[model samples]
Target: MHKYVRMAGFFGLSEPPPIPQSLRNPRGFRPFHFAPDDRIICFYLDFWHVANGDHILHPHALMFTHSSTLSNYAKYLSVVPDGQSRRIPWEAWGPSNARWMEGNFDSSYYSYVHGSRFAYKLPSSYDDTGETQIIRMFDFNPYAVRHSAKVVPAENGEEGTDADGLRAYEEDMTSGITHRDVTSPSVVSAGSFFVDDVHSSLPYREVARAVQYAEDFSILIDEANIILLTEDHTMRVHTM
Candidate 1:
């Protein structure tokens, strides 16, 4: 018996499945989805194992819903081959790299694993299809940027001389020094009408123009809404 099995038994818990001889001990268990209605939990198990005499670390998943105890649960739909040697990076091991859309154990549940870009759908008991569906394969580039034209000055003019030149020089220096001073707040408010006009005229102007990287991607789903947290630090909510 594995040490984990003995430890669980000591706590009055049922013994878990024995680790395969080809696989090493598992580490880094991360829970992803929970269905309160059905008392179901989905989680990832990361481990290092020897495959073809090469050591590799990868992740697999399990779901506990109908089982009588924690030890007995449904393994993920896919399993790593015994001799497969794929080394996943240590930094990539976490819940942030995955997302889940929970459904009442009666209809449908969805999950996406980042590196694989595969969306898995598990149907409920009421589903007549009785088959799992993988759909909508899409590539995600977190560092994707929406390119736009750069702003440029329409024309340049020579500086005026004497009084006008001195005044302009002073104004330029003062502008640079005070650009972010307390007075700028009032100045911005004072130009509220102009700001509104600019906004209205360029309705499509990007407020926070920045590239979104995959690392900053986040998503949340509820019964009536889906919320996405993008790289630009913006929350986009969509109704279901």
Candidate 2:
């Protein structure tokens, strides 16, 4: 039951789109597979992509191990129950996962969620000043996932090689990469693998102040209304 389970890294969020960016059009992560016992999960949200040089804004939001509020409410819980699926196979998706997405979130990419190692979730050695503000969850339980090789097939020999070396030298290279970035394959994830900060247990009735410094957001509780999707792509509706 512990033959493998090593995934730790973090720091994501900031792909809400701007400068002609829309809503999650090939953004990232969105998986699910839960049958009589086939368990699996995934989710995505980037808060509107920007970055260090673009100024600043690399928000974060993800999912995977959700065994239904472990207690203390589990940061108000992020729902996702009821069968799930979404195809998968394109060689698992690049060099398998290019050694866990170029490696490093300390060793991963700020995400992991395979829970149920007997309801895994421990850390009560002392701190519990009445839940102080709960905001820390990291679980593990992977069966098999060790990937490598993330994308190779370009040998121009110079001028950029093959992720698009100046358009393969200039106009019509035969390789692609959206615009740039790719071709650093020395691979590592040998396979593949793949939270934080809180406060707010229902109070804010509305908020979308033109996103001055909004970090991350996502909501959709129905029975009436309450659909917020902040980080500046705007969308606020509260009626419930």
Candidate 3:
């Protein structure tokens, strides 16, 4: 298995039915992050992988990369594949290159260091006495694995930048592959795509949650505050 595929096992993924071509190559969406620490870049990846078992995984995937890296990635995505490494030497690119690409990636810090997100979920029937929304706090400091340095190839005759022997160690860290089935876990790190093999972490936990009437139109979050906008154009703010 190519080393990069470790995210499959780390995220508790197994070979399932073929993914539609459109989703296999993800299209990113809705970029947001908990206030206070913008270090953890949270965005929705327009894709989902049917997990190895019987559960619907949340379709949100987080990616952390330099804005320039993201910009080049955008430009590269637009290119029709011709079986060539899209790696452009650092000297050949400039800020403008990334400025024109999808501009969602814009952080240059380690992280807010700590961040949280709020989701207003539809209430389950017959349970009126509860908070229908959830506020999940993520320890984003753990996933900042990339750095500007030369990457050395494996000394044991492996290809360049291929992760070596990380699967066994990472698998052991989780209770049972992953708790990411129907109920999302308090995991800090997650699967597939790319996280530097050298560093992966589980730093997420349920911090706080709240609920509002179905008429609540939208919700947003900042350092220690929650903002709600209703369909009637009235606004409400709550302290976290």
Candidate 4:
């Protein structure tokens, strides 16, 4: 079956005493694997407009792992920029879209696209890696509608850098599949698959308006089963 099961509702979050203003509108869900049997999902909340003349992309993140239930997740705040005269380029001075790299079991790498000028590969967590590794970058061409890029980290010291650095390449998407067509891809595993939302009739569509946005959903790949977080905010488990 294309869809195993569908859940409906919002993934609620408990307010942490005095909630920081940044996590007010938590959106953008990016799911990645932490281990073969574990999953970690990251949600990015925009805090761009709150910065008053401070050139920073003040976004906050909410992380959910196997150790924590959906209702009980950890919140992280971005560090403020050092008060220095060095200016951040205007192209990189706003909120960015983050996506987890598939097959990165160490959870050390992810990509973020800033504006439409550049896309960068950055370490997932500075504390875990102790260094911000800029694996590669693509200078975006505004005139081009879409491009194909791949960043593959060296395996077993193959590319001359340490065993952990990445090598990347980019090319235009000339086959007619535009970037917007694949902005939000499906999350699939060996046993089951998860989709943002299933097709519904007009009567049900009116009720599912709130959960219709793709960014509000995530999928958890459990052993022999799949947990889908539907646009309507409900979670459902389908057995293989």
Per lDDT, the best of the predicted structures is 3
- The 0-to-1 C-alpha lDDT of every candidate, in the order given, reads 0.26, 0.27, 0.33, 0.27
Candidate number achieving the greatest TM-score relative to the actual structure: 3
Q: Give candidate 2 regions above 4 Å deviation.
A: 1-3, 6-11, 16-82, 90-92, 96-184, 189-240
User: For residues 93-200, what per-residue lDDT tens digits would candidate 4 score against the true structure?
Assistant: 211222212222222113322222112223332333334222232222212223222234344433323333443212213321112212342232332222232221
Deviation in angstroms for 223 in model 2?
41
- Where's the lowest-lDDT run of ten residues in candidate 4? 201-210
lDDT of 1 by residue, 63-140 (tens): 222122232322421365677755553224322222222222211223332221222322221133433221222112
Alpha-carbon lDDT of model 1: 0.26
Candidate 4, pairs of clashing residues: 8-234, 9-232, 9-233, 9-234, 10-233, 211-231
| TM-scores, all models, native as reference | 0.25, 0.19, 0.33, 0.17
Error of 1 at 157 (Å): 65
